[model samples]
Target: MEEFEFITQSADETSILAKRLSEKLTRRDVVTLEGDLGAGKTTFTKALAAGLGIKRNVNSPTFTIIKEYTDGRLPLYHMDVYRLEDADEDLGFDEYFHGEGVSVIEWAHLIEDQLPNERLDIKINYINDSTRKIIITPYGSHYVDLCKELRDESISH
Candidate 1:
């Protein structure tokens, strides 16, 4: 298993980390964000969206199962599975997950079986009242390369 870990003492730090990580993302990347509520997952994604040149506000798609934003370097297919567990919710997930755009899924564990086996997985855990721990796992050569790039950038800047 390929793993890279980072600890952020504050929400700002977590956002910064995500911004930096976004630089390595390209077309057709799948990023799975998994964590408890208030773990700063949305904060991190906001920074990532910023890095990708997305000007629209990135919010938790709790009500809407997925939100598509094209005003970025690449299209962003953002999904939140929090409210998608209902039997009536019909998610045409394949079109977005397999599309050419970059996909980021929040509460991804809910539909983990549908996700690509080789992708970037991010887990955010509350370290305490003022800290958060983020663990990033890369499952394939592409993500592994991205991890190395992120490591180099993290160390140098």
Candidate 2:
């Protein structure tokens, strides 16, 4: 496991970074996004969905809890657990985590106990109105390799 940091100067830059990361993702890959309100969590997810070949609109599933988009190369299971903090229910998250799709969870800390052992955790820090500091931590060998590839990609560009 390792950590990688990137500084994005604008929303477009952040989207580009997320798109690059999405390209290397495979089915069953889990990515957790940690950030405060208006911290670009949903923005990154939209960029990721676009990279996955999704043509439809991507939005935060705040009230719905989970939204599934199957038009992409692999299904995209977008989950927002912000409202789950006080609830006690099995959302069958394992099905999405292990399913034939990539899973991105927002406000993942709310359901930390249900997350798999291997996943990527990304913390977004707002540096300014449009800039962001993205800190990515890989939790397993697969994600470690993903981070290495992302680093190499960044270096090349």
Candidate 3:
């Protein structure tokens, strides 16, 4: 398990960071978002959608549970499992995880048993009205490389 930390002073900064990350994403990638309400999970997803070239609006899927955006460079599977209490619900996660797009799961901890072995886990901590501390953990080599690349780029700048 490898980790990287980033502190954003504002929501715009968080969006910029997420855009930088989205540029590195590829097909079949799974990214989990864990945080409290209003911690910027959907905000990050919106930024990611922009980076993926998705023109549609990205909103919290609290009621829909899952939303698919296909206009991007690759498909974007955005899921909000906040309402789920068990992993027994058959939401057909396999198609999304192994599909031609990337999956972004919010409140992922609730479905821990269903997640793939290799993926990226991100936790957002609210610091103030506009600040947030994001902790990113890579569960496999692919995500590790992604973090390394981001870290190097941040250091170079």
1 versus 3: better TM-score goes to: 3
Q: What lDDT score goes with residue 147 in model 2?
A: 93
Candidates sorted on TM-score, descending: 2, 3, 1
Ranked by lDDT, the better of candidates 2 and 3 is 2
Cα RMSD (angstroms) for every candidate in the order listed:
1.7, 1.0, 0.9
After superposing candidate 1 on the true structure, give the runs of residues whose Cα lies further than 4 Å from its correct spot: 86-90
lDDT of each: 0.86, 0.95, 0.93
lDDT of 2 by residue, 1-157 (tens): 4689999999999999999999999999999999989999999999999999999899999999999999999999999999885645788999999999999999998888889999999999999999999999999999999999998999899
* Root-mean-square deviation of Cα positions for candidate 2 versus the true structure, in angstroms: 1.0
Q: Which residue pairs show backbone clashes in model 3?
A: none
1-157, model 1: which lDDT tens digit per residue? 8788887888778888898888878887999999888888788888999889999999988888788989989888888888765634446776776787889999888887778888899999998977987889998899999988887877886
Cand. 3 TM to true fold: 0.97
Q: Which clashing pairs does model 2 show?
A: none
Q: Which pairs clash (backbone N, Cα, C closer than 3 Å) in model 1?
A: none
Q: What TM-score against the true fold does each predicted structure earn? A: 0.92, 0.97, 0.97
Candidate whose lDDT is highest? 2
For candidate 2, the TM-score is 0.97
